[model samples]
Target: MMRIGLILAGGQARRMGGIDKASAILNGRPLIHHVLERLAPQVDQVLISGRSDYGSGLTVLADRTDGPTGPAAGLHAAAKHLADVPDCGLITVPVDAPFLPLDLVERLCAGPLPAIAHAGGRMQPAFSAWTPVEVAAQLAHRPAGAGLALIQLARDANARTVAFENPGAFRNINSAEDLAAAEADVD
Candidate 1:
């Protein structure tokens, strides 16, 4: 099966003072660079879901629907955009998550249905692999802000959770402090 990486970069970044968390510097490189490096080779294509002006040379997709309805909107937009691809599954990752496992795509695709990472006793929904068909179906039927968390969407689609021992593998740089801590951990 073919897999495509969807890097979610549509957040308002209110917690980080309205800055683009994906462009934030970590170890002298943008956080998105780390995510791209880890995911690019594993997937057939990597698309950034959000603003088109973040950078060039990347397939940037703007959300068709308006307003911030959380990551769900971004996922729906990406699924819709890539709906034509045959046998394509989306491996979603937040742009702020720079320490994603290198084998994330492989591990998520090892199962038949969508699979998300289980770390620190929490399901990291953003780091999930979902078939475009399944996601598109949900997008069509689900109501807006119906408390449909990404995990719920995965479960309704009969998705499974892939457990990873290292919680650090899912650390997200949401704030300046989080970025510093992630850098320190890498050091």
Candidate 2:
């Protein structure tokens, strides 16, 4: 099945002083570049889900709601935007996670159901595969403040977790300290 990569770039980033994490520099390249690189080869196309003000080369799907309410809204928006596409799944990732595994798409698509990365015994919901129609239907009935909970959605959808030995594959850069740690790991 064809897969579309969705980069969730709508977070408030309060910890990063309201800066756009996707545009942050890591190892001399914008973090989003790393995400796109990993996602590009794995999917037919890529879309960045965020506010319209944040112009990016990739297709942008603006969240119709406000705040970091949750990733669910962005996921919902992406699903709705790509509703026309048939037989495609969405591989969603956070823009701040520059170290996402190269095999992320493959591993996610290997399952019969929606799948996520379970690295270091933690379920990384942001890095999972989703079907737009299925996800959008779930979003329509999801309770308020429930949109950000990917784990719950996955469980409800009977999604499976793809365990990986490499914890670095899911490492995310949320603060300057996290960025430092990621940089050190890269070295």
Candidate 3:
């Protein structure tokens, strides 16, 4: 089964002073580059969901009215874009999560069809895999709770929780300190 990788870079980033999280540098490279490198290999194709232009050489799906703001919107955009292709499994990862595990796709895909990544006892909804019918039936609805709702949807559907040992790999680089910490790991 081919997975369509959707980079969830559409967050407002109010915590990061509204700066584009994807462009934030980690290990001397834009976070998106790191995420893309790890993700592109696992999935058949990649789509970046955000308004900011990163020139990442991947399709950037612009935000639309179909979904609410933030991470939910990104998922909605990907689902809508792939609506024509039936049975497409959508794999989503947040742009701020630069240190995503190498086996993220495999682990998520290995689980139930619409599984989500779980680490540090947290349901990382952005790091998830969903089928087209699943998306249309579940995620296509309006976003009332944003990312959290997606996780709940996965849980409601009984999607497997694929856990990773390294919780740090899911660290969110939303600030200078976070970026510095990630940099230290690389250095």
Q: Specify the highest-lDDT model's number.
A: 1
lDDT of 2 by residue, 1-118 (tens): 8889999888888887777788777788777887777788888988888764244567788775532257877888787888898888899999998878888899889876478779
**Candidates ranked, most accurate by lDDT first:** 1, 2, 3
Say which prediction, candidate 1 or candidate 2, comes out ahead on lDDT: 1
Candidate 3 ranges beyond 4 A from true positions:
140-148
Compute the lDDT of residue 169 as modeled in candidate 3. 81
Candidate 3 colliding pairs, count: 0
Cα lDDT for residue 41, candidate 2 = 87
TM-score for model 2?
Answer: 0.90
Residue 179 miss distance in model 1 (angstroms):
1.2
What is the C-alpha lDDT profile of model 3 across 13-72, one tens digit per residue?
777887788888787788898888889899999998887648877888876665655666
For residues 37-63, what per-residue lDDT tens digits would candidate 1 score against the true structure? 888989998988888636648888876
Task: Show the lowest summed lDDT stretch of 10 residues, model 3.
Answer: 139-148
Which lDDT values do the candidates have, in the order given? 0.82, 0.80, 0.79
Between the candidate structures 1 and 3, which one is better when assessed by lDDT? Answer: 1
Residue pair clashes in candidate 2: none
- TM-score, each model? 0.92, 0.90, 0.89
